[model samples]
Target: MAKDFSDGIKLSQPRPYLTRMMLFLALVGFLLLILAPRIMDAFLANPGLNGLIVGTLFIGMLYAFRQVLQLGPEVKWVNAFRRADPGLALPPAPQLLAPMATMLGNRKGRMTLSAGSMRAMLDSIGSRLDEQREISRYMIGLLIFLGLLGTFWGLLITVSSVGDTLQSLNVEATDSASVFTSLREGLQAPLRGMGTAFSSSLFGLTGSLILGFLDLQAGQAQNRFYNELEEWLSTVTNVIDVPATAGENTTPEQASLLALAGQIAALTEQLHAEQRLVRELAENQAAIRPALEELAGSLKKRGS
Candidate 1:
């Protein structure tokens, strides 16, 4: 009459979770688009409102997309693992030790494989980093395009208004009242056009600046990670032959044990470093949380 513990909880697949999140975001974006006109109108009614709205939306969208990109590989890895063995009780995927072993045994292969793997790793990292940069660049370009579109629309309005003023002046025979009215209409068009041009340009520039800053920060973080990974790989690849056991030929068991021991030592070092980093991060969070909360409270009070 033992109860099965597995029935109460069902595990969700990574792919579905990712898809759901992406879909949810898309839906939200669509909703935002639908309300954009009203939102724009509201902003137009208030001073500095457009800046806040545009900045917040651009930053939020960039952050969300960046998060998706960051999580994408993890999701893929998880889905790969799930698809690899359906039983869910399968052993973890084996590491490709053959290449490492071949490299260790053959000096030439060792050099070749080491160099190749290092190059491949570097290239992969560089490609991903480049993709991030490209995305940021494209976003900047899009912003600029939108700004130009706004400028064109504004210019069109200005031109139409000027034409109407001219026609009215011609028809009204140079009366002072007609001139003033026509002039006012002409001014309205240019004024509206200028506002559109300036607002769009401001949003575009602000988006580019914010995204550029975020991209730089992300690049720095990624580079730091890459450096750490490279160091770890270098350490791993520097494995040397351990002295053979006394009075016996070097058996496979002994060699494997030595290699494993070396690997364990390396892993231990890495774990210690990671643990220290985590501890420092936790400590920093602990220290910063209070200050952050206080700042938030002060801002809230001011806003209220």
Candidate 2:
């Protein structure tokens, strides 16, 4: 559904990914509420590492939500500007599209925005979005790293504990009862270490999963907004006929071929002109050579 602004503008019914993102977050919250006790115990097992992972995941979610939120307003703003009457004023555009607004505002009279100009605007907007998503991606990687770090730490502790337990085992006891008690007591250290490893892995993997889904939603919203802006720009984009400017329809290879063809045609024309000049020079020399021979014979007769 399109949102209606106070200025009487309606959206073009974009992807609605922002609403979907909110619903996804809501579902996540509900699941966490139900699993709160289990989650608490897992975190308590490896509080130092698990606590840090949760904190990182929370920050990632915050950044992802902000990305979606920022995109929503910008999408609305672009739609409003696109649909408004050309003679009237539009509501203020979002910061993402401020450069475009400035370009249009600074125009003298009868502004003609070229396709290249629109593309430059989209590039600026896309670069900013890429920067925003980079933070979320980094957080996801960090969560996995923390998980693996905890796993190795736990394994190290488990290995050393097992070795120590085996060394202290007094198998010299003559009675089975004393040997069994020593073995049981020795196993507790390794079991606690194993618990730390499993708990950290579970929490870290779960947190990353949640953050990944949120980032997916944010990416979709940004893509939709970008496409919407592109469509809107096309409406105002003018196709200029410039010999120096390459057309979008032509690839670089095609342009190079065209240049080569032109050069070949010019060379062919020059060669034809040179051939015509050479033919004229030969005809003139043949005609003058006969006249000179006749004059030389007449001079020989007069001298004799």
Candidate 3:
């Protein structure tokens, strides 16, 4: 796979799995989360904690978007295959597709397509896809955990402060001015605690919702890509077996010939499936030539 840099941005197919509506809503929500805290200072008493959660959410979103872009090449590869473009160049190979490309390329055009091999290939692709998406799942869980932590921490501080204020109460003091002042000062701690509690929960829950939705979108994109790849493979793959003529009656001398016949039959089926597949056979000619030469030598020895 080749990387393209027409501009500063790398060119890739299936750009940004997120839709325009999703992007707009997420941007608006983020802006509100950032700005609302400053405007409603009373509600968001602990700006520092809120800021940390917001920053973490931003990092998670960015990471998800990056993964979305990385998945582009796999989608593109499936599209190219479906279009029957043997000459089409690929973009930078994605993790899910890298092993597949390596397998095909290593075959030197003499590719094998057995049911077991196909299952293994699909399993490898699925594993890579799971690994790629695992981070988003962790990020969602982290956001929720942060929210709960903030909520409980704030409540504990509030409860402790209220208890201390009750213990320090000078209710029997004669000075009314001193009493009022002490009461007002005592209330401040609880108010601050309330602010911390509400603000953290707001940001944490909001961030979790936003990221969860985005994760769903990314998962859908991945599933679509996987489906397309499966479809493409189904169309191109051909499995041939030794014919009845080469059954129990076939002599040992004919074994090599039967193998050659089976290979040709498979290739013929491949050509029927996609005209462009024939062009690809040219690259495999050298790879297959040695096998053919060996078979021919065996035939001559038997005849002699």
* Among all candidates shown, the one with the greatest TM-score: 2
Off by over 4 Å in 2: 1-15, 83-93, 107-111, 244-304
Candidate with more favorable, higher TM-score: 1 or 2: 2
TM-score of each: 0.45, 0.73, 0.66
- Candidates in descending TM-score order: 2, 3, 1
Q: Sorted by lDDT, highest first, which candidate order results?
A: 2, 3, 1
For each candidate in the order shown, give its overall lDDT on alpha carbons.
Answer: 0.55, 0.78, 0.71
Q: What tens digits encode model 3's per-residue C-alpha lDDT throughout 31-97?
A: 8788874646733577788787888889888877776776766666644533433434556455667
- List, residue by residue over 180-283, the lDDT tens digit for candidate 1: 77677667766766676666665656555555555555555445444644553454343335576653667888878878889999999999999999999999
Number of backbone collisions per candidate: 0, 0, 0
- After superposition, the stretches of candidate 1 with alpha carbons farther than 4 Å from their true spots are 1-60, 63-113, 171-175, 239-304
Per residue, candidate 2 scores C-alpha lDDT tens digits across 71-129 of 66676666666555555677777788788787765444334567788789889989988
**Which runs in model 3 stand beyond 4 Å of their true positions?**
1-16, 21-44, 78-92, 106-112, 239-304
TM-score-superior candidate, 1 or 3: 3
Scored by Cα lDDT, where does model 1 land? Answer: 0.55
The residue-level lDDT of candidate 3 at 63 comes to 79
